[model samples]
Structures are given as structure tokens and as C-alpha cells.
Target chain A: MKIAILGTGAVGTTIATKLIELGHQVMIGSRSNTNEKAIEFVNKFEKNASNGTFEEAATFGEIIFNCVKGEFAMTALKSAGKGLENKIIIDISIPTDTSKGAPLSLIPELCNTNSLGEEIQKAFPNTKVVKTLNTMWSTLMVVPTMLKEGDHTNFICGNDEEAKNTVKKLLHEIGWKEGSILDLGDITASRGTESLVLLWLRIWGTTIGTFSFKVVN
Target chain B: MKIAILGTGAVGTTIATKLIELGHQVMIGSRSNTNEKAIEFVNKFEKNASNGTFEEAATFGEIIFNCVKGEFAMTALKSAGKGLENKIIIDISIPTDTSKGAPLSLIPELCNTNSLGEEIQKAFPNTKVVKTLNTMWSTLMVVPTMLKEGDHTNFICGNDEEAKNTVKKLLHEIGWKEGSILDLGDITASRGTESLVLLWLRIWGTTIGTFSFKVVN
Candidate 1:
């Protein structure tokens, strides 16, 4: 499968590298055509991996992963332009402050009344926008078995059923079991999952580095 | 220990019962002086349990549990008057709609910007407010060992060390291990924990009723 990962940040690169390892053709997307991180990812991964501008990657893949920062997400998707139309777009960004010395508070403008996922879906009505994997670290996004007992309690939300199934297959490929990936209804549910960033950050500070949430029943 | 529970709702009753069972003198506080639920609790529990209005209960206990609905929390606390001063307030309320047939959306007014815990602290400047157990059901709050594997990963937050310690002891009395209860910085950190109500509610719908979050490291 041809996959496009927008943003050459840790999340994008980590996911791109993982997909490349799984024999998927992966493209690392960035603002600049010659983004150093994207170029470095291509150099490290070699075969089935490449780097390009957000538009080029978006146009190239059947599945597009929006891995950009929430602040820059809309603009990057705008750059991706018409390529996103009718494509399966998986969003994994949270609207939390990532700047130096800034408290990791969710940006009120994006996450308070609305979520980045909702905004993206509104921006590209033609795209099948599915929100998932933003609740955990990028490493955990691709490697669900890393934590103790490997809790597969991941979540997915989208308006389209087919799109959610497609993402679920991808999740299974990355070690998330069928019973583990919970479908959290429509895009509106992103409000809940996205808000999880706050708890995630808090737990990140309190516990050991490698961790994720497991719903104990 | 003398304990006051501010509210006759399920959460308030559940915690009040648990405390009474642990041999503490528990008071069930309500909006009205002759609240039937509180009166019923006193009659049912038989010993170490009483009923009163918010102010009466507040003045009676050394430690107060703010289990009132988030919407009416301030008003209830105001009715509690000066009795909250210097008392350890263990807050388990989330700012979400609780009315019948309500959509159960997190109240954006408090939870979006600040938390009910922080608001209570700010409202009664002399009180030591600790936030905990709002992320799960009232049954789970009192009985943390009910879930599968019984992975106790409860969290608490407050500005005062002594107050947090008091709440921590209460947690241990109710079966939560000392190591399981993490102190998440100061009262400001309540923002993250309070926001968890959204995900909690979503998961509540998707999974079986018996569930709580365990941070798998």
C-alpha cells in the first residue's frame, strides 16, 4: 500500500519508518521539498521509503496520514490541496502547545469548542477523515506490543464505516488486535479522544516513559 | 475520622457509604434539610451515618468530600459557607451534564478552561482541595479492585501536601495501594484529570460497564 505521512516530526517519521518496515511504500511529507528530517528518514529507511513536499506525498498515496502539529495542520492540509479529495485521511495530531518552555496545554482555539479532526473534516468535505492514534506516543502508534502485557485498547472515530474498517486493517497489521481497536462512533467523538491528550501528558510526567492507556474491564 | 459528603447523588452516596463502612462518622449533605435520600442513607446504614443540609454537614466533618454535581457545585459550596476553610476536600465531581436524557457532554464552561477542583479551591481560598476518582464509575471509585487484574492506577492532585496525604490514606483504606495513588503536581493539574471525563464517558458507552484506566508501562 502507498502511504503518505504529512509532517517530518517524530510522529510522522516514526510511523513512516514502521510502515516501510511492513513492506508498505511510505512517503515522508513536509512543508519544504528538502526537509532535513524527511531526507534523513529516506536515507535511513532506503527501499520503499522516500521524502517529498506535503502536496507531492498527498498526491502520491491512496492513504494520507495527517501527522503535522495541530497549529500547522490546516495550512499543511491546504497545501496538500485537492489530492486529499476522496482519499482515506488518518489524523493523529493534537492541539497541544509544543513550543519550548510552553506548558503543554491544548490550544483553546482549536480544542476547546472544536477539535482539529472536526476542523479537517470540515475543510475537506470530499475526504474520509478518520481520527485515531493521537491518544498515544508515535512509537506506541506503530508498536502496540511494546508496553507490558501489550494492551491493545486503541480507539478510532470517523463518519465513514468503510474508512474505519480500512484503518482497522492497518491497525491490525501493526499488532493492534481486532477486538482491541474500539470504534468510537462518528467524527464528533474526536472531541473525547482528542481531549485525552491532557491526561496522556499528565501520566507521561508521573510514570515511566513507555506507557499507554489500557481500559480494564 | 469525621467525613462530610456534599450531595445525595449516586457518587455522594457511594463514597459516604464506603467511608461509614470504614468506621468513619459520615454525613450525607443535600440541597434540602429534609432530603429523603440522605435520610434513607442514615436509616439504611444505621450507625456512623447521619443526614443534614450542605452547611450543617460541612460544619460537622473534619474532612469534606465534594461530590456535588459540577453544575451546582459552587452554589452548594457557597451554602457550605465558612466551614470549608482549612478542611481537606476530596473532589470527585466532573463538570458534565447529568440531567435526564442529557447528551452527557463535558461542560465546556469549567472543564474546557479550568476544572471543578480548581474552581472549588479558588472559590474557598482556605480549603485544601484534592481531585480524584472522577475518571471512573462510583462503584469503581469505592472498589478499585473490582476490575480485571485489579490494576490500581488511581491519581490525585492538590496544593497542600498534608491534605493530599489525608486523601491518599483514605484511598488506601478503600483498597487502593499507596503506590497506585499518584500525586499529580498541584491543583492546576486538575485541568488534565477533569478533561478525562470526556474519554471516560465515551469508553463507558463502547465497553463493558466494569472498567477503569490503567497506565501500562
Candidate 2:
């Protein structure tokens, strides 16, 4: 499947490289010509990933990955334009308030249901918006199954079944265990998960080491 | 410290007996005419836990373990009455809508701002409200350290420092490892955690063999 990772940041770069490694065609989108850090990070994985503007990547791929920082998400999707009309966009956007400018103060914006992810979906209503991947730290997004102990849980939510199924196929192709993928239901369900990210960070930092969760029964 | 467990349900009985086994004075309160199930459950343990009415438990203990169902949390507190004033109420209520009769819905009554735990705090304004134990299943409430490999987290929120210390100490005695307890600050934070109980059910049920979480680095 053709996959365009929109936003060449840490998470964007990590996911693109992993998908490329799985022999899938992957493109990296950036508002600017290049993100030196994101470019350099991807170069380490291989030369297969091509970088371009949001429109170029959007038109080129069947699916889109929303990896832009929450603040620029709307602009990024708008740049993707009419190409997003029926595309499956995996929302990895977290409405983190980096406003005070400290990682510690970067709290989830779910204190309001009208969060940034909600704003992005509103912007591109034609897009089949699914929320996933934002729950894990950027470093853990690649083949997260490598970090799992058993039937772990990675949640996905969207209003479109076909879109969700496409994302699930990609997730499994890149190492998600089949039954472990929990379909949390509808794009709005992402609201709960987006808040869960903040709760996770409170524990992921400090004396405890960061780890992913697996819902084992 | 003398501990009082409100609502003689399975959760309350389990927590009281566990605390008593740890050598604390414990009382279990029930509105159901003192079921034999509670007494029998208590007798199997080495702890000396006595059963009584809400008022009796409140008058006897310095710290109260509030574990009534989400619907009756305030009623249970009110039944306990002025005795709860200025005392530490370790609230374990979540806005779980068992009214659909299913264990899954996050009823409107329980939410990010007005969670059942927070409601209990608002009702007994003088009572030091600490929200914990609502995030994990009732079964894992007793021995979390026995199940996992890392610093899995449990959150607590309250307005009082002394009460947090009291509950923190008790959590340790009940086999929660050091540094595993998190104080999210003030009674309102309880709103987030109390609701997390439903969100947490998915992961807790399968992993840690029944609602156990450990932090790993």
C-alpha cells in the first residue's frame, strides 16, 4: 500500500522508516523543503523514502499519516487539500501544550473535548480520520510489538470500518499482533485515548522506565 | 491508624481484611443487615475485622476507605454523616454506568471534571479526599507487587498532605511497592483517575492477571 507520512518529525520519521523496511512504498511530507533532523534520521534507515510538500505526498499516496505537531495540524491538512477527500488519515496528533515551553508542562489538551485532533478532523471532513500511534512515545512507535510481552493492546478508533481495516493491516504488517489491536470505535473515541496519553506520561517519566501497555487476559 | 471501610461489598471486605492482616484496626460497614458472606470472608484471614453499620465504622476509624458503588457513593457518605467531616476518605468510586447493566459505560455523572470521586469530595468538603484504587480491578487492589516487573502506577489525588501520607503508608503496607504510588494533587484530580477505572478495565483485566500494573524502566 502507498503510505505518505505527513510531518517529518521524530514520530513521523520513525514510522516511515519502519513501513519502508516492510517493503511498502512510503513518502515523507513536510511543510518546508526538508527537516534536517527528520531527513537525517530517515537517511539512517535507507534511501527509499522521498521527501516533498504536503500536496505532493497527499496526491501520491493512498493513505496519509498525520504526524505534524498539534499546533500546525490544521495548516498541514489544509495543505494536503482535495487529495484528502477520501484518504485514510492516521491521526498521531497529540494536543500537547508546549506553550510554557517545557516538556514537563506539555499536558494533553483533552481538558477540553474540543481538542486539536478534533479540530483537524473538522478541517478535513472528507478524510477518514482514525486515531492511533499517539499513545506511544515517539521512540516506541516502530514495530511496537518488539516491546510487547503478550497479547498487548494498541487501540485504533475511527468512524470508517474500511479505513480502520486498512490501518490495521498496515499495523500488523509492521508487527502488531492480530488480536491485540483494540478497535475503540469511531473517531470521537480518540478523545478518551488522547487524554490517556497525558496520564501515561505522568508515569512514563521519573523513576520508572518508559514502557508500552499490553492488555493481557 | 484505625481504618474504616464503607460498603460491605466484596471490594470493601477484601480491603479491610487485607489491612487488618497488616495489623491495623479495621471495621467493615454494611447497609444490608450484615451478610454472612462478609463475616465468612473476614474469618479466613488472620486479621481481626469487625462488621458494623456506617456510623459505627466512621466513629471508630481515623481513615475511611470509601468503596460504595458509583450511584450510592454520596448516599453512603451521607449515611456515615458528620463523622466523615475532617477525616480522610479514600474514595474508590467511578462513574461506571452499570445501569445499562453492563460494566462498561462512563456515565455522564463521572467525568473529567465531575467524577464520582470528586462528587464525594465536594459533599464532604472537610473530609480529606484521596482517590486511588479505582483505576485497578478489585482483585488486584491487595497485592500488586506480586504480579509485575516494573514501576506500574496507581494515582492518588487529595487536598491534604497528611492524609496523602497516611494513605500512601497504608498502600505500602498492603504490598504496593515504594514509588509506585502517584499523588496527582488535590481532590479535583480524582476526577481523572476515577474515570480511568473504566478505561483501565480493558488493560487491567488481561495484563497483570487481573488489573495489575507495574512501572518498568
Candidate 3:
């Protein structure tokens, strides 16, 4: 599948490269006037991952990833244009404090609410927004890494079953097992589900530092 | 330490009884006219636990368990009056959706956004609010029957270290291990930390129906 990625940050670059290496075409969209930084980031993940402006990139691929920060999620999506309609929109952003020590940005950063992934769902009501990868570290974005026994529990949630199934297939292709991609129902669930990112952070803090969770019975 | 439980529901009753059985004094607080159903719920947990108005219950104990629905947390605290000051407050409530369903009466059956818990903290400004137990099922509110390796990770967050320590002791008294009780730090984390409750529900949906998460290295 041709994958068009918006916001070529660390996680985005990593995901795009994994897909590209798997023989899928990858196009990364960026607003950076001098997008050399984003280009370099993508190159680190996989050589030959393409980068372009929002419209050009979105028009270039079948699958689009909204991998911007939780704060810039809406703006990036809004700029993805109506071309995003009916496309598989992969959402991987968490609402965090962008303004930890400075004057608070109006963004979801420093936000303690239902949040950015949710806001993405609301803003692009037509796009099939599936929430995943927001719950793991950039290093383990593709393959589901087991940190313990009975651990196939990388989760996903979306109102559209077809969209969820598509993302789940990509997850499986990226190494998520059948049992690993646990879908927790529709987008309204994003309220509680998106917060899983925090659990990942806390877990990552203690672990030898792997973005993984193993569900032990 | 005497525990004054501010909200009397399925969860409030469970926690109140378990504490009493563990040899702590417990009081159940409901609105002015708590129905027989409410008293019966407490009776299921403890025969000795007393039922009183919110203020009476708050004034009756040393440590406070904010067990009400997240939506009415403030109103319950207001009813509790100055009783919330200088105490270790164990917050087992989440900011859940009340308006999407019935009124506050049906809140315990739902979940809230990070809004409601923060609201309670704001109302009881002097009270040291530590968010815990909100992440687990009321059945596990005490301790899990089947113990497994790497099985207890309690994420606690509050601005006051001493207050968090007090709640940790309560967790220990019930059945938590020393390393299992993790301090995630600060009330602001209440947003992401409490959001894990959603991830937990997904964890619950998979096999091994009843379980809790333990942060393992």
C-alpha cells in the first residue's frame, strides 16, 4: 500500500521507513519551509522515504499517517485537505505539556483532558481515523515487542470496523500478532484509550527502556 | 488510620469494608438521605461501617477516600466542608462521561475525563489529592487473589509527597508490594496518569478476565 505520512517527526519517520522497507511506497508531508531536518529524520529510518508539502504528499499515497505532535495534530490534518476523505488516517499523537517551563502554549500540551487524538477524530469526521502507535515508543512503532508473558496487547480503537481491520493488518504486517492488536471499540473510546500513552511513558521509565507491555495471565 | 469515605457506592462500599476488615475505622458518606440500597452496599463490605452525611463522614476520619463519581466529586467535597484540609486524600475516581448518560446518580457506572478529578482537587485546594485505585476494578480494590510475577504496578500522582506516602501505606495494608506502588509525581500528571484507566479496560477485555498491571523493569 502507498503510505502518505504527515508530520515527519521521529515516530513518523520510523513508521514510514518500516513500511518503505516492506516494499510499500512512503511519502512524508511537512510544513517546514526548509524541510531538510524532516528529510534527514526520515533518511535515518529508511533511505529513499519521500518528503513533500501536505497537499502533494496526501495526493501521492493511499494511506495517510497523522504523526504530528498532539498539539499540531489538528492543524496538520486540516491542511491535508479533502484528499484525506475515505483514506486510512493513522493517528499517533498524545496530548502532553509542550509548555512545561515556558508560557503555556494553547495546544493540548500541558492538557489534562480527553484530548488530541480525540480532537483529530472530531476535526476530520470523514477521515477513517484509527488510533494506534500513540501508545508506544518510536523505536517499537512497527513490531509488537513483548515485555512479559501473555503480552500480545498493543491496542487500537476506531468507530469504523474496516478502518480498524486495515490498520490491524498493517500492524500484523509490521509484526503484531492476531492477539496483539486488541481493538477497544470506537473513537469515543479515544477519551480513555489515548491516555494509554502516559502508561507507556511510566513503563518506559522503569524498563531497561523498551516501549512494550506484556499482558501476563 | 481512620478512613472517612466521601462517596458511598459499589466502589465506596467495597473499599470501606475492606479497610474495616483490615482493621481500620471507616465511615460511609452519601447525600443527606442515603437510601437503604446504599447502606446495603456497605453492608455487603462491612457490617460495622457507618453511614452518614458527606460532612459527617469527612469529619469522622483521618484519611479520605474520594470514591464518588467523578462528576459530583466537587459537590460531595463541598458537602464535606473544611473536613478535607490537611489530610491524605486517595482519589479513586476518574473524570468520566455523566452527561452522555443519566444524571450524577448513575455516574459510578461510568468514567470521566481528567476534568472531574482535577475539579475535586481544586475544590479541596488544601487537601492533598493522590490519584490511585481509579485505574483498577473495585474487585481488585483490595488485592488480587491469584498472584503472578510482575503483577502489581500502581501509578500514583500528587503534589504532596507525604500525602502520596500515606495512600501508599493504605495500598500496602491491603496487599500491594513495596516496589509495586509507583509514584508518577504531581497532580498535573492526573491527566495522563488517570487516563490509563481506559487502557486498563482493554486489558480487562482480554482473557484472564480480572487482573491489575504491575510495572516491571
In terms of lDDT, which candidate is strongest?
Answer: 1
Which candidate has the top score in TM-score? Answer: 1
For each candidate, the alpha-carbon lDDT, in order, equals 0.84, 0.70, 0.69
Candidate 2: TM of chain A? 0.87
What local lDDT does model 1 show for residue B189? Answer: 75
Per residue, candidate 2 scores C-alpha lDDT tens digits across B141-189 of 8866544642466777777889899889888878776677876666766
DockQ scores of all models, one per candidate: 0.66, 0.19, 0.29
* Per-residue lDDT of B134 in model 3: 73
Top of the candidates by DockQ: 1
Q: Please give me the DockQ of candidate 2 compared with the native complex.
A: 0.19
- The per-residue C-alpha lDDT of model 2 at residue A72 equals 78
Q: For model 1, how does the per-residue alpha-carbon lDDT over B70-186 read when each residue is reduced to its tens digit?
A: 888889999999778789888888777655342366566576557788888998888999998877889988888787645757878889998888788889899888766767778
Candidate 2's C-alpha runs over 4 A off are A20-25, A30-47, A51-53, A70-79, A96-128, A143-153, A158-166, A172-191, B20-25, B30-55, B97-110, B113-126, B143-153, B157-162, B179-192, B201-211
Kindly state the fnat score of candidate 1.
0.67
lDDT of 1 by residue, A113-165 (tens): 56788889998999999999988988888888887645657889999999999
Quote the positional error of residue B212 for candidate 1 in Å: 0.8
Comparing 1 with 3 on lDDT, the higher-scoring candidate is: 1
Cα lDDT of model 2 overall?
A: 0.70
lDDT of 3 by residue, B137-206 (tens): 7867676545574365667778888888878877888887777676766665665556565566655654
Error of 1 at B97 (Å): 4.5
Provide the lowest-lDDT 10-residue window in model 3 chain B.
B102-111
